[model samples]
Target: MSQVFIVTDSTADIPDELVAKYQIHVVPLRVVFDQETYLDGIELSPATFYEKLGKAKVLPTTSQPSPVEFMNVYSQILNDHPGSQIVSIHLSSGMSGTYQSALLGKSMLEDEQTAEITVIDSKSASYGYGLLALHAAQLAQAGKNAEEIEAAVLKLHEQRKLYFLVDTLEYLQKGGRIGKASAVLGTLLNIKPVLSIDNEGIIYAVEKIRGQKKAMERIIQMFEQDFAGQRINIAVGHTANPASAETFISLIETRFELGEVVYPNIGAVIGSHVGFGTIAIFVWPA
Candidate 1:
């Protein structure tokens, strides 16, 4: 039986320490500001990205990892592990081209003497995708075969839920993720829209509430109604909004018995679209 290696893009929002500890390979996306491009989480850290984000006159743009980049990682893994299988998990194709790039890379490696490369579209982002990658890596580390690991992750992926709150609709508006009319209405009503990832990994507005506090309360209420009886692995993501993230964490700790609560800083690619003062909660059924 061959070993299995796990790979994911930087949008997973996984910390560098954990990436190294788990031996997970990451293909970085690019973030461009003012015609200068930097690898997400490679050349730019979250803190640095946010600093420049605030100062820059133009909004940053993001690009997925190229097919060549993905091929490089896959080739190296094949060289190191000989016939090992590779599981490349990534953000949703609906939102980014990372998944498509990975697929192209797999096609390029048809002649390689490996078990196979399985490219999975997490249909989610940030901690939601990170959690799936983490679980897959854990399974790979435990010597599970690629098929088994993929099966395990697929089960968890179906049960995962991501909810987020953005401080301003400007970033989303600029990205064309939300309509201009809706953004204007939201701004006028002081309505903070609570957003979620659908089964397809596409982001959609679930509800619009009056204030940030009410939005948070509404998130907790929805969690209670939908996930009350289930044990969960919770992850809170923030972009320069530690206070709000902490408040969400506190509420979850008080309300549920969770396996663990991970606090990961949102990385540049994700931060660029959501912008500052973004707070998100990722819950996976335990």
Candidate 2:
């Protein structure tokens, strides 16, 4: 059996320690703040990125990694591992071009070599996507074949759920995720929209609760309802909102028997749209 190499983009939000432990390779997206551009996790740490986010006059923009970057990573992995298979898992294609780039890169490889790489669009983001990659890595390390890893990941991907609450709609409006008119109206009405990523990889507003507290409660309720009878592995994601994340973790621990609850800082690419005080819950059947 060939060794399997795992690859993922930074938006998956897998912790650095875990990445090192699992021997996973991550290709970071680019974050542009005015004249300065930084690679997602390479040039910017989450704490530093959030600090600059607060003081920036203009909102930062994110760019996906080029196909050449993916090609280089994949080629190097194959060279090092000899006959190993590469599985590149990434954030939703609908949300970013990272997945597309990986696919394009894989297509560019020679016919015989192409079969060595498998790219998957997780159709999820943040820790939600991270959990999928982590699970894939675990299976690969356990000597599972590429096909086996793909089947396991797709199974979890279908059942995975993500619910997020943002502090304000300003960033969403700026990102063009929500219309300016809707942002204004939502802010005026104090409406906190609970958003979810659908199976198609698009983020959609699921419900609008009147207050933040209610929104938090609604997130838990929705999880209980949709995820009933399912043993879950939960991941809590936040953009500089430790307090809200803590509250979310506490609620989950109190109400559910969660597997491993991983807390990872939302990377710059995803954080740029959600802004601060964003708390997201990622749940997968255990």
Candidate 3:
């Protein structure tokens, strides 16, 4: 039987335990603080990245992995598996070029260096992408073929939803990920902006309200409205904010029937832009 293998980038932020359990391969994005460089999840952890961000003289920046990086990782995996296929999933193309790079790298390999490889743009971020990858890995382990696994994850992607709260818009503005004017205005207004990734894979502000307390309430309100009385799979993501995550999760458990709950800290690539005190929740059908 030809086995299906899974690969993803660091932005997925899938918990380390799940990554190890599923034997998923992860290629990392880059995070640069001042003149120093670090790999997204490897060299710079969420806690470390947030600490640097709090006191850095100059703001950090991020870059997607080069195609060569993907090619190298793919070559190694294929060499080990002989003829198995690769289902390479990644963060949204709207946010990074990692998906495009995965494609280019697969094409550059010699025919024998790797067998068939499929690259997917997850159209989500943080644990949202991670959940898709997690599900894909599970399917692959269950003896599904590459095509079957890919289709399953694509269907799941359509159902994926995320809502995040940012403590401040300064990092987003400085990173150029958010509109400066909007960031400035939101900051001045003391709005706890709620953000979501659209179907097209672009991050857009969903709503803006005052204070963190009300913002958390709004997230639950939206969740209850969308998936009420239904069992759901969820991930609660944090950026150096465990208490906040626990509080939000406690509220979620009270409102909905949760089938699976995963806790993963945001990786540096995302933290470089969103900064600390960021809590995001992703929900999908169980």
Candidate 4:
């Protein structure tokens, strides 16, 4: 094992393959469908969650894991990897309290677990945060110390760009995330919304277009503005539409040279809020 380890919450939407390859520990959030609840990505798979979402009468809700859950995960990591240090990356505190929970968990740790564990609010969501955790894992695997890995992760978190294109605004409206009632009516009238998270990690509508193609094209144009003349690390995530994601990625490749493009299904936690037919893309320096 490496001298350092990485941990993140389910909100990161990291691909299983990469998580397995890096041995990144993931603590799951809870997804509740009325009376039923399941751990995000544990008892609930993305495919099953999306399928149920399409047919459910009511939308599911999500809750962050408790401090006990995080503490247990921290303890398990220390138990499994005896002298290793930990960097616990998590979803933005603005979106959820998972980061604060991690911090509390770390504080409650035994003396041995105290000095080695560091909790970070990624200040981004989906694979935007996933890539940050991945970068830390890479550094850890290369034998970098915890402090060095953390410094690199924070720098990347600041530079990461994330934008999502939703098929409708109903989810945002119903979830009370969209403040304007007009936006909800606009969605019913067939307006696609391009959204991005602010520095505070709250989602905001960047553009509203009449058609899906125009919205996607506009997103591509925005990508060119940020990543033009340089290679970038790109990650594309979807609620359930892989075909749309693949086609969008093809268009992106034609516009800019990419180092590697990771495709991960949007997890149950994010899916519950974004609804179906949402395609989000994240970009950063390679």
Q: Which runs of model 3 end up more than 4 angstroms from their true locations?
A: 111-115, 179-184
* lDDT by residue (tens digit), candidate 3, 1-286: 9878899999999888899999999999998888888998889878888888889888788999999999998988888878788999998887788899998899899976545888899888888889999999999999999899989999988876789888787777777766323533555467888888787887778888788888888988998888878899888899977787788888889888889887889988988888878899999999
TM-score of 1: 0.95
Per-residue alpha-carbon lDDT of model 2 for 53-76, expressed as tens digits?
A: 999999999889999999889888
Q: How would you encode candidate 1's per-residue C-alpha lDDT over 181-283 as one tens digit per residue? A: 2434444467888888777777778888888888888888888887887887888999856777788888777787888778889999999988988998988
lDDT values for all models: 0.85, 0.85, 0.86, 0.85
- Regions of candidate 2 where Cα sits further than 4 Å from its true position: 178-184
Error of 3 at 38 (Å): 1.0
Per-residue lDDT for 243 in model 3? 80
Q: Lowest-lDDT window of 10 residues in candidate 2?
A: 179-188
Task: Write one digit per residue (lDDT tens) for candidate 4, span 1-286.
Answer: 4488898999899899999999899999999897899999999999999988888899988888899888888888888878889999999887788999998888888987888898888877888789999889989988999989999998887877888887767777666655432343547557877788887767777878878888788988987787779888888898867897898888888888889888889989888878888899898988
TM-score of each model, paired residue for residue: 0.95, 0.95, 0.95, 0.94
Looking at model 4, report the run of 10 residues with the lowest lDDT sum. Answer: 177-186
C-alpha RMSD for every candidate: 1.9, 1.9, 1.8, 2.0
Q: Which stretches of candidate 1 lie over 4 Å from their true place?
A: 112-115, 179-184
State candidate 4's TM-score: 0.94
Candidate 2 scores a C-alpha RMSD against the true structure in Å of 1.9
